[model samples]
Target: MSQSLMVAFDVPDKKAALKLAEELGGGQGKTAKVGMELYYKEGAAVVQDLQEQGFAIFLDLKLFDIPNTVQKAMLQLARLGVDFVTVHAMGGKKMLQAAKRGLEQGALESGLPAPKLLAVTELTSISEAILKDEQNCRLNLKEQVEQLALLAKAAGCDGVVCSALEVADLHQVVGDDFFYLVPGIRMANDQVGDQVRVATPAKAKAWGASAIVVGRPINQSTDVKTAYQAYLADWQGSEQEK
Candidate 1:
C-alpha cells in the first residue's frame, strides 16, 4: 500500500473545510481527514463536496458503540465513498468485525471500494499517568496499545491509528502487513498543544508510519502551503539523505 500524509480538516464547518482543501490541492487529489468537529456540523454533504473537488476523504469519527449500532453506522458511512474510517479499538473484536461487515455490505451496495477500517489504539493525548489513574488500566501504555492492535487485526481491520512512538514496536509485534497510521504530528518548532505524545514528521517516517495525520501545524500556519510542503518533505525524507 502507498503511504499518505493526510491533512486533517479540523475546521468547524463545510465552507471553511472546503476552502482550505481547495487552497491546498485545488482539486488535484490530496487526502483530507474530516474529523467530528466538521462532520457533526456539516454531515455527509461535506464529504461529497470534497470528493467532488477530487480530494480523498478520511472520515475520522472514531466510532465506538454496540456491535449492531456501529455496524449500521458503518453501512451508511461506506456509501459516502470515503477512503478511510476509524473506530475505537477498545470496543473489542466483535464490534470491529461488525464494522467491517457493514462496510463490506455498504460498499457492495454502493458499487465503491470499502474504505480502509482503521482502529484507534490509544489517543496521542493520553499519557501513562492518565491511563493508570483515570482509565484504571493495568498494562503500560505500550502494552495496552499492542493488545488493542492485536484485537483489531484479528477482527479484520486494515490498520490502526496510534502514536508515532509506538509504531516501531508495533511493527515488530504486529508485522508489517498491517499499516500504522500515526497522528499527533508536529514539526520541531511547533508547540506540542494538547497532544502529550507528539512526534515530528521525520521521526514518524523513521519509525515506519504508513501514514501521518497532521492538522494544526499545517492549518494554523500563516503560510499554509509552505507548511504543508515542509511537512511533506520531512515525511518523504526529501530534506535528508534516504
Candidate 2:
C-alpha cells in the first residue's frame, strides 16, 4: 500500500478548502482531512465532492458525545463513505464500541466500506502541564496515551490519533498492525503554532507513525506542491532508510 500523507484541510471557507483539495488531488498524496471548521460550514457535500475528484477523506471531528448521539452521528458519517473518522477515546470504551457499531450498520445500509474508526488519544496542542495540572491526569503523557490507545483497541477501534512523540511506544503496545494517524507535523523551519508535541515528517515516519496529519506547514506554504514534495521526500526517504 502507498503510505498515507493526510493533509489537513483546516481552512475556514469552503472555496479555499475546495481549491486546496483540487491542487493536492493532482499530487501524490491521495488522502485529505476535513475537520469541523470546513465540515460545519460546507457539510457532507464537500466530502462527496472531494471523493468524486478521487481523494479519500478523513473526517476529523474528534467526536465526543453520549453513545446514542455518537452512534447516530457516525451512521451519517459512515454513509458519506469517508476513509476514516475519529472519536475521542476519552469518552471510554462503551462510546468507542458504540461508534464502531454505528459505522458497521451505516456501511451495511449504504453498501460502502466501513470507514476506519480512529480514537483521539490526546490532542497535540495539549502540553504536559495542562495534562497534569489542569486535567488532573496523574500518569505521565506517554503512559496516559498508551493506556488510552490500548483501551481504544480493546474497544474495537481500528486506530488511534496520537502525537508522534507517542507513536513508537504505542506500536509496542498495540503491535504494528494498529494504525497511528499522527498530527502536529511541522517542517524543520515551520512555526509550531499552537502545537506542543510536534515532529518532522522524517522523524514521525522513523518513529512508526502509520500516517501523519500535517496542517500549517503545507496549508501556509507559498508553494503547496513543493512543500508537499518536501514532506513526501522526508517520509519516503525515512522509510527507505528504515
Candidate 3:
C-alpha cells in the first residue's frame, strides 16, 4: 500500500463503512471512500461523523455532469470536508475547470481545506477494446494515458486516477509531483477480480505512483488486519530497501 492506498469500502451502507473502519485500524481506521451506495444512504452526516472521529474521507462520487452541475455538486461535497473527490477527464475542460473552481470557492466560503480534485482518466474495468470501440479513443494505452494526463494537468486537476501500470509513463509526461492516484492494484499473489492492468505495491511504486487504491486483497481477507499489515510491511520494506 502507498501513502494514498485508500482501501475502497465498496460496502453497502454508512453503517458498513463505519464498522469496517473500526475493524481495520490505522488509516484504514481513519480513511475510507464513500461511493454512490453509502453516500446516498447516510449523506454528509456520515462524512461529519467519520471526520469527527478523526477519519479522512474520499467522496468517490466521480462527478461527471455538466459544468454548472458538477460545480454546484463539488461545492456541496467540499462543504462536507471530504479529503478528495474526482471528476471524469472526459467531462470536458469546462466541467473540470468548474469542478476545481467550485472546490476552491467552497474552501474560501467555509474556511475549510479544499479537497484535492482528481481526474479519472479511465475506470480500472475498462479494456483496450472499450477504449477503441466504445470511447472512440484512437491512441493506444500509453498514448491515451499521456493525452489524458496532459488534459488533467491543463484543466487544473491536482492529479489523475490511473492504474499502477500507467504511473511511470504518466510521470514522464506530467512530472513527479502531479499526483497519480492509482487503483486496480493487486498484491503479488492476490486475485485480480475485475481489474485488467493491476500491479503490486513494489511495481506501482517503481512505476511512479503517488498512491494506490487496494480493495479486497486487504478488506476481504479472512484476517483483514493481518492481511493489511502484511501489505504495509511488504510495501514499507520495499521502500526502505530503496
TM-score (all chains, Cα) for each model = 0.96, 0.95, 0.92
Show the colliding residue pairs in model 3.
none
Better of 2 and 3 by TM-score: 2
* Candidate 2 structure quality by residue, lDDT tens digits, 1-242: 23388888899877888788666645233787999999999998888877776778899999999999999999988999999999999999999999999999999999999999999998998888999998999898999999999999999999999999999988888889899988999888888999999999889988999999888888777888777777877877734311
Regions of candidate 2 where Cα sits further than 4 Å from its true position: 1-3, 25-29, 238-242
Error of 2 at 160 (Å): 0.5
Off by over 4 Å in 3: 1-3, 26-30, 238-242
lDDT of each: 0.91, 0.87, 0.79
User: Whose lDDT is greatest here?
Assistant: 1
User: What clash pairs does model 2 have?
Assistant: none
lDDT of 1 by residue, 87-162 (tens): 9999989999999999999999999999999999999999999999999999999999999999999999999999
Give candidate 2's whole-model lDDT.
0.87
lDDT of 1: 0.91
Candidate 3, 10: how far from true, in Å? 1.1
